[model samples]
Target chain A: MSDSPDSAKKKILLIDDEPFITSLMAMNLEDSGRYEVREQNDSLKALETIMDFVPDLVVLDVMMPDLDGADIIYRLKNDARLKHIAVVFHTATVREAELHAHGGIISGFPFLAKPATTDQMIEFIEKHLPK
Target chain B: MNSVPPDSPPPAQSTLQQLEEGGALSQFASSIAHEVCNPLSQIVLATDLLAGPQPMTDEFRKKIITFLRQGADRIEKAMKSMLQTCAPIETSMVAEDANVLIETALASLTVDASVRVEKHFASDLSSILIDKKHMTEAVAAIFANALDAMQPSGGTLTITTYAKVFTSSEREGWQRQSWFRAGDHAVVIEIADTGHGIHKSQMPLIFEAFYTTKVAGKGAGLGLTVAKKVVDLHHGRLEIDNRPEGGVLAVLTLKSAAKPATFLSQPLP
Candidate 1:
């Protein structure tokens, strides 16, 4: 294994049911040169992909069938192995105020709204990722 | 008007005042709540499931919270309307800045990143006397309806304000019944969206209470009705025109204090 930090890239796991948004985020994140992106479109298979990828950061979409994003967070928080990884939420369910109120339990986790600009998405990922 | 005997007491005498009034208001509130509750309930159940002990991983919690927040916001709006209608007015009415109100309401919208929100405020326009809360709600309701008509596809929304003059004679039906005076100053705000225009037949019942074309559980048809009530409270006029380019144009006209009289405003044909 190469021990050089310069050549190594941080991987990111994206779990979203929507192909459009997920693909858009993946493309933008990949272009940012800071992340290696792995996507899981279905929430049910999200854990397997996360476990396999062991990403440095996780970006989750809220509205999914079987295994939604919030549940994924609860599980990640409890799992000691995955607990250290940073998480960012991307959703368009409500405005900022409502999100702020409901984001009470998920301290320190970053959030980005859907249909966001590439710059906005990149900024979120950069801010939440460990240096 | 003379059908009732001159010695007869008012209708209040025949009905139990508190029971009747409270019953009617509660029914209206319950109906509105019922309409909003469907979506809200889905969110709550979804949130509860997300919060359950079944183990939600780090990847999924954010999404569940978003759904719950949105659902709560919807219910809050409905509850706000109910409270506004049921509670007695305590604040004095005054001239309010239409531009400010519209901007405040638009800020709450979850406009897609692709969609651009544009506003054109008339600098010389006079302010209209109205309740700030109700006026804001009415304008917001119109904008919300417009957004629903244009969401996902993402398009530009233009809200414009202007000052105009209208004579009472030009206004008819409800306007005439309400005794709109000639030479009244009028302030108009138009919210134009880029979406599928309203159908012709739907126009007739657009303002009718409990009338909506939205899919079942999507809307209670109270948006326009509550909006109309707010407009009535402000002595204003609300009009919806289907634009040829494919969208709904909502025009809100409120009485202003100073404008030279022109042709009477024509009612919707």
Candidate 2:
């Protein structure tokens, strides 16, 4: 919100099939003035959006129809340009209980369950992103 | 006519049976949870935004409130459909015959003329308490699967209707180790086909929501789920097995209407 022309603002991409969740996260992150955010509902268009936005962090959903988060991450890992982009799987596909059951880890990344408060999502981003 | 006694509770079933039922329900609930949570997450964020220390004009506050209300209504609508699928149909249960129900389901199917239709209904088959429309749809779903399995090449669709008392253990044994209730006087409907049989491993997973072996667009994987739910609601069970020689045999059992009591009275001299 503040136009201070600071380079410190982190760029974040929120991708999920649910448009409402993306909108909510986008609004919260943008309002904080701490991140430049892009929201993509269609996972197939995720790469195109990433190319256009070139975000610092990506919040990917795992159960998307066009492409699952794991597949997207695999593609990202293969590509040099997008390989460095940090991703946190925020989804209902692998629930919180499942992660806990498996000793608190899934896909070797910080995971956040759906119906999460904005604070929890922001906290995860802050922890993962370089200060 | 006998009614369920007011003070008497229905007999308790095995934990295994309960577990199977729970699995079916939890699978369905997970789908609902995802849909419901999407809207719920929005409401949580919008409310947070409004309640936060950020300065907002009255118009903006109104907008946020509108989104909140919309999210709430969306959750309600999703939950209503979820409940509708699983809820008992109190008024629709009537004393209906299984033979008639099977015929009605068969008639509704869009089967090719080459597919042979065979019906063997017992003459004295007892009436069942069921919702006619749903029961028909459930049978229709099984038939749809049979038709798919034997596609292009035709097959015999042998449907047999008979009445029998099956103990819970017997139903369990019949499935070559499976699960269901203990005892019931049910009008059993067995629909057999001559098509390729189901893979044994996939049998248990078939009732699970979204567990589909069919190619995409050909199936939503809800047919068997709906059938199971319907049978459960009608106080019955559904079993699908591979026939020894070939193809699949799907058996549906529904509790029959209670037989009238015949009383003997002393005659006056």
Candidate 3:
């Protein structure tokens, strides 16, 4: 990742249960050298990782075991400090509209589907993140 | 069996009898379909209500919708099974790999993760001429039965296929006619499940229509029946035998449609 002496590089967290998919994403994103990519498979430790890593963008999966992505979005959106950090939901879930209509305002800033391409994820981050 | 009398109250009477029989079967199937569809409609309605733009703090609505979708799929399958049993199967022939078909069916099932699935297939085997949908349904039913036998509590499921030659001795009284010669080539597909083995007494009637060991609403006891019908439609023989290890083995023997060839060798032990 390209980081200036004065500013840190943008960090992206990719959370998903499927190992093959997440590893593929992490490899692709890390190889890009534009953004630092971190992966979390454990849903329970997701919030802790977010707090510790302080990622610029969070990529969340929906069909996780303990906690779902939508619920995590709700929690993140409710927190004052984390609210500013852009969350991009990535899941194989059946319904996307309901997640978008969280109390008339979508909690997750952007949503993406599973098996997403490299260009799509980067475009989402670029569009949503502050300059 | 008594044949229809020659007088037969004219051809119209026979036509009327056939029509009545067909109508009765259709009505019975439609009634079952209606019963299944009513609850499905309710689930859809419930989802619509839950998805209303109104505010709700709890997230149980999504869970309920998922449950309803699963329930609706199961019921839809049951109704289709019943309807299939009452009608003659219509098959469309295609070149299909048996191993691939079995794997696809297994993947689509909502089986328990604990159950072990093992596949032993002959890679050099020729493509079989069969209807993909009916074959898939038949394989899925057998797999579902195996899963039911081994889920929550785990067990191994083995699927194997190979070429074989059958004799009258092998079929015995099961064959309606002795059409088999000494060297009739056939393909055998075996599905073995390690559930609670079938009791000795229930063995004879397990595949009979309307005979089920499952409780009410859990199953209509038609899985094996429909499976057998599909096999028969494919000009195949469905055989069931108790496994030595404590389970059931369902073997389907389909006449080889590929070029005729002698048996290469018995599978390695």
Candidate 4:
């Protein structure tokens, strides 16, 4: 039997402090069959997980304990090995209307406001995924 | 002829009042929105999974239902906390021992065994006019915050009560705050904790509703807000500052119901 083109799924890493959120999101994305999802609930260990997983894309929550999304982005951008991976912020820190007004981009980075529909998240992920 | 109404406040005062009210309303609304978003996100995601095209096992179904319930419960809890904090307090003031109130507050909480509590109540401490129930809640809130700061590393929680007569110099130092007058006898209750002190930048917003350093689900961020409100209703002053020797100290000063004796003459319990 020959392998299908869709069988090679894109790898996505989700970093959020909320366990339920990461769990539900991973399940939903993996169910779609277009992606393989990994969840990291600890923001402190996010970098280590990213390095080991080497996911194609990373979705992070903005407000986290110890280290925040921006701090992680700074570290990622500074590190040559991790700089090339795509990053998107999934946050509840900003209002959904504000996110929309900014065209889903905050501080020169892609953003998806919390309570977003699965379609919206998938669309955002697809749009921001590295080509 | 004057165009402004005779009973109206001065233009500058009115403007300042407006600004203060507007700022409070804005902060409250923003806090509610932000706090609700986390639970809402969970609900949306959970529902999305339930409606997904994937085959659902019995385990997955049970998990999703649990997630939905958890999310709903969180939202309900946050709303209840917000309402309780924002509600207008109806206080019945009476002369009560400050130490008793602190004890009452402490008794209500389940203080961890790792945290040691020390009380240094003044033998000559005067009773203060307070709504006992509300004041106890305020003190408990402060205690809770102190404990939270210590977290996994428990520390000593020191509570001290003393009485003082505010002198003209002290009044001037406080910028003639309406809460106290010169020569007024006041009882001071200090709740100090040997925990990581709050950051200087965050001190201004600490009392603001839903402004918390704790991770989501750990708090609704209304504890200090409610505490401050209760103190304000009693015309008392509540000040929280980082102690020099480490940790944070919360000083609550309320008007003494009776003439306070010379605290220097009394022995500490």
Off by over 4 Å in 3: A1-131, B1-81, B167-179, B260-269
Off by over 4 Å in 2: A1-7, A92-106, B1-36, B52-60, B78-130, B136-224, B231-269
- Per-residue CA lDDT of model 2 for B1-269, tens digit only, reads 12333232223343224336575445555656665776788899898788776788999889889879978887787666555555544335566767888878888988887688788888776677666787788889889988877777888889898877666555433332233345546678998988878777567667765445554224545678767766765557788999999999998876666531111233555
Binned by DockQ into CAPRI classes (incorrect, acceptable, medium, high), candidate 1 is incorrect
lDDT of 3 by residue, B199-265 (tens): 7756765665444555224565677767765665555777888899888898877666553322245
All candidates in order of lDDT, best leading: 4, 2, 1, 3
Pick out the ten consecutive residues of candidate 3 chain B with the lowest summed lDDT. Answer: B7-16
- Runs of candidate 1 with Cα error greater than 4 angstroms are A1-131, B1-91, B174-181, B210-220, B259-269
Error of 2 at B263 (Å): 36
Interface RMSD of each: 14.4, 5.5, 17.7, 2.0
Task: Write the residue-wise lDDT of candidate 4 on A21-48 in tens digits.
Answer: 8888888887777888899988789999
Question: Per-residue lDDT tens digits of candidate 2, residues A1-131?
Answer: 46434487888999887776788788887777788888998788988888888888889886555465766777777789887788888876574334443344345777787778878888889888755
lDDT tens digits by residue: candidate 1, A3-96: 2252477888888765534554565555456668888877878777877888888888654444556667878777887778778887644323
Cα lDDT tens digits, model 4, B1-269, are 11222232112222123226646766577778777888899999999988877778899799899999999999999888877765556666667878888888999999998899999999787777777787898899999999998878899999999888878634312223334666888889999999999888568778878888887799888889878777765657899999999999999988776675455456888
The per-candidate TM-score of the B chain, in the order shown, comes to 0.63, 0.63, 0.64, 0.86
- DockQ (C-alpha) of model 1? 0.02
* C-alpha TM-score for every candidate: 0.46, 0.55, 0.46, 0.83
TM-score of 3: 0.46
